[model samples]
Target: MTVLVTGANGLIGRALCERLQQKKQAFRAAVRPGVPVQPGCDVAEVGELNQATNWCRALTGVDIVIHLAARVHVMHDKSADPLAVFRTVNVDGTLNLARQAVDAGVKRFVFVSSIKVNGEATKMGRPFTEADAPNPQDAYGQSKCEAEQGLRQIAMDTGIEVVIIRPPLVYGPGVKANFAALMRAVQRGWPLPLGAVHNQRSLVALDNLVDFIITCMTHLQAANQTFLVSDGQDLSTTELVRGMAQAAGVSARLLPVPVWVLQAGAKLLGKGDAVQRLCGNLQVDISKARDLLGWVPPVSVEEGLGRCVRG
Candidate 1:
């Protein structure tokens, strides 16, 4: 099947392209201007994603589309209206692509959504599932949620199939942001005040996420379905730091700071969001993907972490 992968230079997109090449699947990579595409793969240069953008050239002879291009949330965004910026790309741009895909005779569209669609955090021991109503907290999450709704409506209006996969924090080789920072700190033998933070969060390795995305490409049961994906392993803040330390060949020096104390200090320092992320309970129940699509994460968390550190 001929497939088109947007955002081909991104973390998950690049990994997915490599895997698809390994499997000898025919596909085309769509990358933004100045972003390098995977060598030996068919490529098209698609510029900024917005409502006015035309995808006719990129959609040529493609049967499936994996839309990953979006205006991701900035931690300290200076934009006056973050939601409007997000909606322009994540919602309107996505819908525009979906309509063009339908016109182009595309059979399926796989969307890589965020776990924030379910909510920012979950109660201890109560993981978020696909059945739960969406409760997006931030503009980014709200945009994704709106995109999902728009895609579903388009799917209903047109006969094209739409599959949504919401993954929590994705980490692996080439991962940046918090995960990379944590790994660097661990490798440097820095002491972290997370021993008393017992909150659990789920993460999906790049390999696992790519595997699931490919599975959804042709799985008959995945049509018009929304699936929550993870590595099937949950880790607390302390455990995660220790695991990273193990991979980095260092001892995890953790300070036993009380969670309440940490929260209060973070609030005073205007770092409450950072504190919540570090000590947040964000778990996902991925039974639907397992039972329905017959998919499981092939890589263990330990193995994935090792690759992340080594890379």
Candidate 2:
């Protein structure tokens, strides 16, 4: 019942470590060199994740491998060759680790993927489902799709169990990136004109994601399967902001500005990328996960958002 968690110091990884610790599970945390080791868990530095050497070291005595480590960035990448960089870290690195894990006789390999494999929703009413074909629009999302294909091939060849969990925007205590920025804005009582926007997006609580990950571990039905999971709830931008404000003990005086205005302003100010994210419908349906895993997200959206605001 031993497990190895890559990127254990990350936002979701930290939550997963806490979850495993509470369950009294035997776990090992792996991170790249120079990142601080997670507290209260057995930790190891696997050097460069891209390099195959010493990868076997982390796989030793590991029954389950949760591959969470990958190249991630929050903004439009400045690199001239972002895909090359992403491939080296996300695709090649993933395959290298999986091959090594198979060699180490690991029982299960759980890969945490992004919902962007389906496509970041472009409109409020168009939510992507598991049946939708992968149409990754960005370098990061495309790299994840490539990784999924590579993992599937490796699983087919090695017979090692592979369970892929693709989750949409996940938020909880200590979450960074977009969710953190929203919390900071609300904490300062900064005004946001997003009340008028009705874009619905699916989100996962860190606890729920961790529970789903554990369910995929050694679950006979999860072998060679791909599933999308979320909180089983969708919230509009206005509702999300109001909930966030309430969670942070702030006034819910959200401004109702036009969505086109936001888009126009973002474009005029060279913030079109921001507009794309703020106004998009990055939603996913989780019926497949429900039916296949017989699992349900325990944390409600309100409860999850409250934890983030409190932090």
Candidate 3:
């Protein structure tokens, strides 16, 4: 089976392609025009993804298409219409591609969506499940949720299998953004005022997510299903930082600041969203993936963190 992977140079895309290569899977890496092709892979230069982007060249002879490319969440978006900007790519582009894939005889399309589709945060011990109603809080999340809805409609009409995988914070080598900043801070021995915060967050290692994606590529049980994926272990902010420090072989200097004080200070500094991310509960229950696919994360969180820091 020839698999076509979009966003082949991204963090998750890169890892997924590497794993596919190691297994000798027949695959094509679809990258935007001018983006250098990954070495030792069949590549198709599909230009910017949008409602009108032509994907015929990329979809030829492809049995499965893993759609990973999208307009990712931005911290300080300057767009006048954030939702419209996101839909142009995340929703419109996604549905456009799925329609063309169906025409191209692609049997399955696996979309890598975000946990933000569930909501920003979950109450303690009441982790999000696949059956819960969507409560997207941002444009990015809304776009993904809309795309999923459209894909479901297309699946019903076209008989093309659609597998949606919603993963929480995914981290591994080459990770950037907040995870990277946290790693740098820990390595630099910067004292963090999150020692007293107690909140559980779910994260999926790149390897584990890639594994699940590959499984869904052909697993019969995965067709037309949505699954929430994680490392099967939840960590508090304190535990996460300590784990990072341990992985980096450094000492973590975490202050025992009260959660309310931190929240109030964040509000005063216009960093409430950022602080909520640091001190919030956003766990996802992966029992469905476990019970249905019998898939376990091949890499432990400690090992994944070690690879991330040591890389």
Q: For model 1, which pairs clash? A: none
Query: Against the correct fold, how does model 3 do in TM-score?
Result: 0.99
| lDDT: worst 10-residue window of model 2 | 48-57
Q: Per-residue lDDT for 1-311 in model 1, tens only?
A: 89999989989999999999999999999988788877898998877898888899999999999998888868998889999999999999999999999999999999999999999999999999999999999999999999999999999999899999999999989999988998899899888888888899999988899999999999999999999999999999899999999988899999999999999999999999999999989999999999999998999999889988998
lDDT of each: 0.93, 0.85, 0.95
Stretches of candidate 3 off by over 4 Å are none
Candidate 1 residues lying further than 4 Å off, grouped into runs, are none
Give candidate 2's error at residue 296 in angstroms: 0.8
Q: CA RMSD for every model?
A: 0.8, 1.4, 0.7
Model 2, 135-246: lDDT tens digits are 9988899999999999999999989889998988888888888778877887788888888987878889988898999999867889988898989888888888888888
Clash tally, candidates in order: 0, 0, 0
- Clash count for candidate 1 is 0
List TM-scores for all candidates, in order. Answer: 0.99, 0.96, 0.99
lDDT per residue as tens, model 3, 1-311: 89999999899999999999999999999998788756999999987789999999999999999999999999999999999999999999999999999999999999999999999999999999999999999999999999999999999999999999999999999999999999999999999998998999999988899999999999999999999999999999999999999999999999999999999999999999999999999999999999999988999999999989987
